[model samples]
Target: MEQQRSFGSHTTGTLYLVPTPIGNLGDMTIRAIEILKTVDLIAAEDTRHTQMLLNHFEIKTKTISFHEHNTQMRIPELLAKLANGETIAQVSDAGMPSISDPGKELVRAAIDAGVPVVPLPGANAATTALIASGLPPQPFLFYGFLPRKAGEKNRELEKLAHESATLLFYESPHRVGKTLAAMQTAFGDRQAALARELTKKFETFIRGSLSALQTYAAGDLKGEFVIMVEGAADKPAVDVTVPLKMQVEAIVATGAKPNAAIKLVAKQNGLAKQVVYDAYHELEK
Candidate 1:
């Protein structure tokens, strides 16, 4: 149990979670700049990348490297500084720290040590793309960067297939097409939008069905990508008591291929495909 009074007087120093610009440096907030200027130390995901931002703003505060590779070793050192009442600011390469970045562990450690953690509002690629996505804005899930492996990505998509809230994801230029294609298979050609190069001069948003976006991405996949997918339409309540084998049969009776029926039944019932396959085959026999 940790209590945080952001501006309260405490013996320990506060940890500021500062958000950097996702692309455009102009997106950096005034408060973020002030905090960066005054903080005792800045723990940046990429010291060299952050140096450019610091130089642009003329911020002279000292900085140290704190990214994925060195997080385990850096946490204890950062925590020690915080314990010594040295205010520390954590910033990622872009956007808010710990939002698909490298500040979560340090923040967790600071909280466990009873240190205050304060977050400043600033530029975020996910939310920036979301507002202009032309899809339902509220009640969206920000899933930053899907798994790279095909099977893992498919399983993750399977879990989210029934979600009713708008879905958001970050993908690299190289993986955007493949990710969109996977989304098409899992979600079945839902309304989708792809936002790329956000806040930069070449920013572009492509809105259409998932299939259409996949095709568009295939041609020229450059710049970072933020994908916003319309939610699964409100499905009528399903009867969970129905036997898995019967569900497969019903889908098959509707002219769906046996293999496709098994997959559909497995997804609907939240059962393994093998389980549904075995039951369906036994029913056939």
Candidate 2:
């Protein structure tokens, strides 16, 4: 009875969210390796691909597939194991999982189901690109990747135009040309950088205006890309005497994103936002 009761208490497993190397296998961390070894099972986005990585490091831990395609079905089973005291670790094909990789849904599900999720920060392409970008890092948004369609891509870039943060994105070599062009159109003459093939022998970082990057990609597009674009230049105080609401309404009328449009128009008009606010208040009334 004592042995059975002791064994029965083995329940609820902790989940670990592991970050793998984006390029070089040698970048894998010792803690990550130890966690992977200790976990009861490893839920990998691509088992075969991770096998190569594990084989490189001589990590003999068990790996199972739990990618986007099968995650819907596998998540429930994973949760069941977790509830039964089986520790599971998740890994993506490369870089961090769920940032354009699998494992995000599982992480959320695990959280909702009361499973403990331990995040082991290691290698991430977004930060890698941002650091190499040489752009001011403050107030930057990591967009991951834009939609493939030209119209949607442009729309997304338009939304980011007035963000005033260094913008970051991941891009494939094949699509880098078109992405640069769309960025040029949406961002206009903004400063930008293209960090490509990061942490690899051919790692390259191209810093210039978005227009310049477009031309570079036209001739020398190779390797994956992480593009970082400087936000729109801040408005000088040439204008600022209006109430905020009027500015908001004025920009909303021009089909600009209400928030960005308002701020830009306020700066352009050289009026205090109070005046714009009064005008907008009247309009509301």
Candidate 3:
């Protein structure tokens, strides 16, 4: 009988980070199945959830809970298996692990211990929302979640409002309206996309300015939401590619005030305040 060998014996056991489907089961890959089935053990964010997945595929591989709450405690046990030449796999309830979910801690520990980590990428809400956003895409920042504190979230929003690229965030159903309102306050007048329930039957995407988004969600908004805020609107003669200082100089030359120039420059460049501020200051010297 061929003992199910996963990682190379010469090297420490490889950690397979598998990504599951967001909504549909058909999204699971053949390669991901092979890795999951063959591993010595599996670390799941939710054991009961993963048990259903395993039963569907008839994969009886052993699994243990490895989530944010228990991940720290379970690290040594998982590492010991890897140290003893047994491979391990980690999966979330949906999508990939370590993205606003648990498993990041284990990944960090594995790297620090010189264990090889292999990624089996598949579905991610951030990427899905960006593709369907219909906004000026690329060069976007992926904020896994806004800060829980209202003040912290606002400060972060204020910082990103100036960037020329799109701003993407993952928000839950309960806080969608609050997040939309916060963005409206910090970002102001910007066109945005509230893509909710991605890949699900009732998936809906709302496109408009921040105010429009708040109003749209004000009524019966349900399920998860992917908020995509468009970068600053196009401006006149303000090149977005140049260094912040040079760009600011060109705009300010056209009789634009420093504060207005700074604000507009950040928007035009789709850059943060610090990046734009340094450039504005350099141009003044």
Q: What is the Cα root-mean-square deviation between model 2 and the actual structure?
A: 7.2
TM-score of 1: 0.88
Clashes of each: 0, 24, 5
Q: lDDT for each of the candidates?
A: 0.88, 0.79, 0.81
Candidate 3: residue pairs that collide:
163-270, 163-271, 164-269, 164-270, 164-271
Per-model TM-score versus the true fold: 0.88, 0.80, 0.79
Tens-digit lDDT track for model 2 on 250-279?
555533444445445555776665555556
* Cα-lDDT of candidate 3: 0.81
Model 1 ranges with Cα > 4 A deviation: 237-283
- Candidate 3 stretches with Cα past 4 Å from truth are 1-9, 233-285
User: Relative to the unseen true structure, what is the C-alpha lDDT of residue 277 in candidate 1, on a scale of 0 to 100?
Assistant: 91
